[model samples]
Target chain A: MIILNQSKLNPSNIQPSEITSREVFENRRHFLKAAGFGLAAGSALLLSRQSQAAIAPVTFKANSRQKISGFSKTAYGAGEKLTQYEDVTTYNNYYEFGTGKSDPAIQATLFKPRPWTISIEGQVKKAKTISIEDLLKLAPLEERIYRMRCVEAWSMVIPWVGLPLASLVKWAEPTGNAKYVEFISESDPQSMPGVRSPILDWPYTEGLRMDEATNPLTLLAVGLYGEYLPNQNGAPVRLVTPWKYGFKGGKAIVKIRFVDKMPLTTWYKAGPSEYGFYANVNPNVDHPRWTQSSEKPIGAGLFGGRIKTKMFNGYSEQVAHMYTGMDLNRNF
Target chain B: MKKQHIVFVKAAIWLFALLPLSRLIWLGVNDNLGANPIEFIEHSTGTWALVFLLITLSMTPIRLLTGQVWQIQLRRVLGLFMFFYACLHIITYVWLDFVFMWDELLIDVAKHPRILVGFAAFLLAIPLAATSNSYMIKRLKTNWKKLHQTVYLIAILAVVHFWMLVKKDLTEPIYYAVMLIVLLGIRVYFKYQPHLKSKVTKAM
Candidate 1:
């Protein structure tokens, strides 16, 4: 099967010998150049762990929760580690790190997440800055394999390791006016290079409705692929709302502000027509640019047929009551 | 019009045109086009068609600017090829994107801004390609000139369609815009200056 993928990618024999010697054969040269690149890329995956480390040694382990019980190992590099698919993770949105997936791994590798602190400010009664270590110290960990749907029309099944967001919020103690929980990553043009691109303002911001944050479905993940988080996967800590689009989960978080009204989200700040604050993974409500009814799974590549996106990304049983009266089409 | 010369020219241009189209087809076949493969293919083919269309549009201006009168002969061939790629572009979207699902297709046409501009450009090209013959020239001798005026509108939409498609890094769009401005500018100069038009036409 592996050899089959390589067999068709032969670029050396792309043009006949006659064509290469033609007076106008710019394309033959271009094909020769492209074929070289394709072969190098195809070989990179077969390298041993130690060999791959020479390039970028980010050792990975399985989600710690997989060690616990009946949760069968998953496809999200579970019970294993992850390698960079510069094309996939880098280009798509895994919003916990910011909307751009590639931007986070590239920009976030510089963010010093270790020995980091998260400040719980705004309407929270016990507002204080706490070390991430102390925050992790407060809760017991579990692994949950959740369906992640991006608003951009892609989905992934990831086994995330973290505790409920409720556990952290309860520790913070929300006050009466706190209707929204605004999760903000530290803004550093020096670190988060995406902010430097003028795509969105520095320090990504995502908001969850007060009840939504309290819901058991929301998780504060610190690990994926069964080990410490990769920088590209929003290392250290980030939200994991399995049912909502990936953007709803903020990454490399530094500020947790409890607010009264609905907080403005990053995509909404840039273009409200596409992303709604409540970015539920719904099939009926299409993005202004594309359909939300279907999504491509990672590694499925282009020719792979799309899977039908579910209501709330198939987590409706756990979260559907949150929007009992509101029209999903409108809220979406 | 030697048989062998015509055959070799056709083969060369045919091979030249196939490269870009083949990359897309290869990617589509290999499942590497990206998440929204249908959209990616649609946008890609559409963009290439616009590029080839713009390249076809540029021929006259380039000839005018460079004093290369012989460059004019390639215009009809390039124009016809533009339509060929444009057909594949739209067909790929209709077949793969909408999957020929009529109701869903209508909704997509209504919702997607990118699809609208591309669809409009495609509709305009049909007439342009159909009229590129001696029979149509003889039949609509007077109206043919007026009906073919739609290429100007198609060219502008072609550029706008590309500009709107880009999320950032305006370089590609700007490059197309420069070509478009030159193409349209030469037409405008020749159009208004009737005496200069004959001189410009004869010189080229």
Candidate 2:
């Protein structure tokens, strides 16, 4: 057994993040912690909400999911964990599965995703393809509750399990030429039914600038709700960049290319006029098709104007600095 | 037109037209619309617009095959309903989708060349709907035919707008495309190639 010592744990902090969109969001616990609530006591709420999971949450292969959490078991209560378990799993946004939400839930099982391989190539010094099993074995699964912001202006918080991209990057000795990382989804049409569609070319691809890829917020998520990620959530592996819109974080990642330039993403290529490349979850920048300032919270909430979307999806502390001097509006 | 034919057509047309208007009111009142209610409403109204257009296009074919000229009068009513639904569709897209998001909306309008096509189609139909009455038809005399001929182009654009928005599995838009093709084809064959016309014109 590979014992992970505290000193060996490379906790890369986002000290450089400028927090430009800092006005809208504040961590509930950070506020509560400042108000003198014990961190240990607050974490007990995670187990408390196990009963609140769902009337019938999907029972996957037991603990196929690893838990490499840095936090204590009692240190739970990240924002609404069950926000979209029912809706998200059933009604997903996996284009590989298909356009409609139910489409992915029904079709993704065709792919034998378990024994998958993620090709890690391009600008990195250690450019080697890593098997999914090896990747999971290298790091323990850590449950992190995160708010997923979709470009459609909807929000959901799920207890995601996986290691940080920062952790993985450290292991893969970088030569420092990698300015951006591009993720390419598998192009198996028989398995990925959406590949049959002429929507935006087959084998969906999304990318992140170098700084964004290394950011602490960028996660290589594997599971959710302490269970193996459902087929709809890109079983095996998916990227979870919390602050950016959902589309920016790719699913079923097959390749990680370290490039000198930013790769053209799927949504941006589909309609460059409508979808910008740096699709950050910025409320200020309105989509050519709709507004982004406010969002509809999935599950139970008021019909009209329930929650206002925050800039960087409340991840300004972790990712804001990546956009240093560039005009977000112009790039948007 | 026969006395009974006029009354029957007018009453039936009015009753059918009221369904869309009432459904619109119910949607607005109950807030049955989704997160982006504007898109849902736009899609719904736009669908009805195409439905009305198909109904309007079918009128001439119905009269020709059945040897019933009374069907021609219902064409105006269906055409007007098409314009009505189109107006709502455009209104929802402009007002809510835009949220009066004027600057972005203006940019979107300027950027998408297709929006201009859609706008032009809607604008042309306005005059046709405005001059749909017997009074305007009587006044315009020869020009009425010229003004209403624009609907063929309008139908094409509405289909284009639909095709542009839909992600894939284009069965619905393709169906509309096919329907429009059949309609325009019928008009062409009847006018230019009379030899292609079937001698036995049986009505469904």
Candidate 3:
């Protein structure tokens, strides 16, 4: 059992250096404002001039991400080089924003992750809606650096700060009838441009079996890189199951329903033949569109090529027992 | 068109056709190719190749509509540009993405329909690009037209390769598919409606 150190975790005691300098932050805002004016004046010139700038490496210093304090570091992904905070935040697959990898960073600027409430219902002993502020205080957050493998064959090592889902499950007090847990993400059409499109059904949903939810490796991520999550990286609260593909970590989640039966996840519903309910990181089971035997690390650069993928993304020791006697290829 | 005018136009085409490659190099040098540089390069080159393929296919249509013969002369350069970008795209995939891992590549080609179709499209473009020279065209004579006609097949395969690769949003691929269909459809319409063809010829 972990003991809470209230003083060490105080938000006000956060080191100033951990936060972006005010000058740089202000400059970035000014640059963005200038770019907006350029867009209004002559978009053609802006397009030609900023073509390369559009793909420039994003710096965390540009945005003043709130510093998350008091979380203790865990040995998750020890010795692994963490992917740059810029790449992890900028390159995302939050389909609610847009399909392009960089789209989330550009489009999610207006997304408001605060004042968010997750409704916990279904087979739980008592259904309740908890605000994001209340949820953060439920348990002591820990920074767990984990290998995040995407279904698209790219991977990242992210330092996620959050409490275990088991803690939340214990708090929810699920009844015996609860067999599965479904996560539903926010689908505000006004802020989320991708939701306006008919891509994969809005309010993206993902799920986990009852035991999987209670697993120690499953994290309810609220922050990354020692700061509150950037909007593009699923601000407020999101799920992070290190053993599964990154898609299993639903972003901007607003609902946690404990149900008796399996939930039809958004991706599974979109392409039943491609995505399966048990999206465990199985290297042997290739996605229908591409090979899953290898994955390119996000910050590996051009020549980094790809490294061989591992079973359960190298976390088989912890999560493989959950799938004992079951064929991963079928349940993949 | 006069000889000088045609030369000037050809030079402009050369400059315009090489812009995508130049832009890619500039981005690479500036380190602005985003988080996944290899994927960015692969996508940029592949999209340019498709754009050039569609442009090459449109030359005859442009001539048919405007009753101008000058645009037809640009087809060879346009087609070659398509092959050039396609080569870069494949090289990026093989050397950078796969790192010449022949065994994995073989498995990828065999297992994935998207890779197979894209590879087949590249292979088909080889013969067309090879026989594009004047000497080879003169030597092949009547058979040259038949060989070059396979460009239509290459375009179809390229479009299908893109369509298959996209995860869900088919908007971009659908645009390319529609463009290819319209280009091919124009020829089909002209073939079926000889009266319209004669009228176009009379106008020319």
Cα lDDT listed for each candidate: 0.68, 0.69, 0.85
Greater-lDDT candidate between 1 and 2 = 2
lDDT of 1: 0.68
Give the CAPRI rating of model 3: acceptable
What residue runs in model 2 are displaced by over 4 Å at the alpha carbon? A1-83, A109-111, A123-134, A143-147, A152-159, A259-261, A267-277, A282-311, A327-332, B1-38, B61-70, B87-136, B167-175, B194-204
Q: Which candidate leads the pack in lDDT? A: 3
TM-score of each: 0.75, 0.69, 0.90
lDDT of 2 at A158: 74
**Model 3, span B1-204: residue lDDT tens:** 888898898899899888878877887787767788898888778888998899899988877777787878889998999999999999999999999988888889899999999999999999999999999999999999999999999999999998998999886788889899999999998889888888889988
What TM-score would candidate 1 get against the native?
0.75
Interface RMSD of each: 9.4, 16.8, 14.4
RMSD of candidate 2 to the true fold? 16.3
Question: Which ranges in model 1 have alpha carbons more than 4 Å from their true place?
Answer: A1-91, A94-112, A297-303, B1-12, B25-39, B133-139, B163-179, B189-199
lDDT of 1 by residue, A1-332 (tens): 11111121221111111112322344444554577977646644443221311222122223311232222343333443222233323444543333322334433444566778899999977779888888777677777677778776766667777778998898899899999999997667665545656656556899999989989879898876555566667767889888898888888788999999898888788778778899888889988776677775665544444667889888788889889999888888
- Model 2 sits at an interface RMSD, in angstroms, of 16.8
DockQ, all models: 0.21, 0.04, 0.34
Worst 10 residues of 2 chain B by lDDT: B195-204
